[model samples]
Target: MTDSTYQFTRAITRRPAASVVNGLRAEDIGTPDLEQMLKDHAHYVATLKSTGADVIELPPLDGFPDALFVEDTALCLPKGAVLMRPGAPSRMGEVAQMAPTLRSTYSEVREITGPGHIEGGDILVTGREILVGRSARTDAEGVRELTAIVSDWGYRLREVFTPEGVLHFKTDCSLLDGETILSTERLDASGCFEGYRVIHTAPGEEACANTIRFNNLVLMPAGFPKTADILGKAGFEVVEINNGECAKLDGGMSCLSLRF
Candidate 1:
């Protein structure tokens, strides 16, 4: 395994048109104008690489169309890549497909399965603490099991739960930098992520909470002017990209791909 400060060597992304969203049944969201979607995805991939992050495009899956493939997951520490067991059943195939891609990039790759389903998006890794959100998507059994697996690496695991109806903790909160955190104002912070400086986004800027910290740069969804300004003031070079099409399917900048 490699010991280096979080350098994102590879990433995996899919075209939004191919994303599978379960709720929007009446409207044909999957069959949108793919030409433009492809164009946008290409631009996104290019921008991600421009940050010096290697980007790997996964071959599209045939059977599962509405897979919450990207956002509903997480990547393991060092070089032992543990593909998450996604909360949504439709996304199960994504982990299987992601395995080879990870093996091609890293030396060791593993899977978190059986009686313990979890998502990478719900797990936030700071200097030494690994904070996981136990919600509809991730369960206590999953967190305990994963913590045990990664304990040898010396990471402390903590669990937080959101009030009912909040899909994922990361959907409303994200660690922006070493000491800074971007979170939705509505989240209950009583015992969650204590001691870190909290930066609150505006009412509708909850989506902006999903920013990704790659190297020294922060990739944020374009259009949240206030959130961008806040991040900029905090000494992060913020790069904004339009994820309108992906956003329609409950996806965001961070949700579109995984960095490792």
Candidate 2:
């Protein structure tokens, strides 16, 4: 399994249920317009498939309001997948729901059984190293479990702390490739991205830090012109999508899919 985000061959995503407006959100950003959200999600899936990945589209789980953000439930690796136990108690059972899908594709599926809570969003798999963030959603035991599981997969592990205002580690950073990172000023100053070439999201476009690099195309949220300009100048082909609905629930480009 290479650490590069551009080396992925497949991805998994889920349809947002009608009850998505009931999903978790930090800032009371107003409710997501369900009708438009479905439209945007359809376009999102299309954009992902256009990147040449074999997209696994899962049906909506009406019982789980935030199930559309499937990346939080598990992680995809070259060797296998790890079913996560999300730190938010409300999101716990999502991991169990994702297991059948993982079993169908992976050979070495692992689980982070509590008193360990880890969400895929708090983990960054870059090249041969795995960076786990110590956040409200991922504790010390979670990081330890992640380390033990990834060690056998031949990955070097390191722990970084998520700043108070950030939701997840990846929320402020994304791998442009194995050697380059697109991040926000806050995270660049955190020392978690020392060895890589860190490109700060344009000053007012911090949300751009959550974009995803799939193969050569950068899948980013629309409405962030400055950051898009920077990425364009950096030589990445950008594919912007309207993420207003998803953003209402704290979701982003990477959160909607699990790529590997």
Candidate 3:
């Protein structure tokens, strides 16, 4: 049986460390408060567990400032998991740190051993196909390598473009379900999501577009009331978590965990 895009039996997450204040960002918004970030992280994991999924809580990696964004380390799928090669030089070590865990969990684990770089944040797996966007951290070569690897597993990978200035392809959109997508107006206008049911984020609430549909709940960043209401009315069970702290480091709900 194929994996449902939003259904999962387990997830992996890491605790935020004090070094998170030094995480890379597109611009300096503010230093993420460690105290608040921890609180939010706990809430995120709790919500996942509440969905009857096993939540693997990894210890903090103080050496990696962006370790809290575990989803970027690898892509978990039903067949196995693929380790990503992050474009950010500072984040390369993170992949090694995550490898052991994945190896122990998956009988087959592949790595993007390449001159090109990619991150899990740039890849979105829907029910029908895998959509990947080339960003500063994810290049054509990286996408090509990933395409080759997943193709052997009988998965179709499609190349797309990330909106200009977006940190990741998923920074502007997310899968609401197998056939539905939640996207920003700018991203939807790019036509990448053509042929899929699209729900545009309420104007000015584009930041909330990076949400995750985990099992029965749609976990989104708190404070985007309009977008939250839209999801609720659309027949989704929505749960809002405080994202102010992670937002400083360009992280969101989907960034915190790897589910499969």
Q: Which candidate gets the maximum TM-score versus the true structure?
A: 3
Q: Residue by residue across 1-260, what tens digits does model 3's lDDT show?
A: 23379999999999998999999999999999999999999999999999999998999999999999998999888877999999999999999999999998999999999988999999999989999999999999999999999999989999999988999999999999998999999989989888999999999999999999999999999999999999999999999999999999999889999998
Tell me the lDDT of model 1 at 10.
69
Candidate 1 lDDT tens digits, 137-232: 788878877887777666677888865666667777776766567788876354586787888886678777877777767778889998898888
lDDT of each: 0.69, 0.88, 0.93
> Each model's TM-score?
0.86, 0.97, 0.99
Instruction: Name the TM-score of candidate 1.
Output: 0.86
C-alpha-based local distance difference test score of model 1: 0.69
**Candidate 2 wrongly placed segments (more than 4 Å):** 1-4
Stronger candidate by lDDT (2 vs 3): 3
Mind giving the per-residue lDDT tens digits that candidate 2 earns over 1-260? 35454777888999999888899988998999999999998988898788788999999988899999999999787877989989998999888888998998887899988788889899887865788888888999988988898888887889999989899998998988778888899888979888888888998899878988888788999999998998899888999999998998889999999988
List all candidate RMSDs to the true structure. Answer: 3.2, 1.1, 0.9
Q: Check candidate 1 and list the clashing pairs.
A: 20-66, 20-67, 73-120, 73-121, 74-120
Q: Model 3 lDDT vs. the true structure?
A: 0.93
The runs of at least 3 residues in candidate 3 whose Cα sits more than 4 Å from the true structure, single-residue gaps closed, are 1-3
RMSD of 2: 1.1
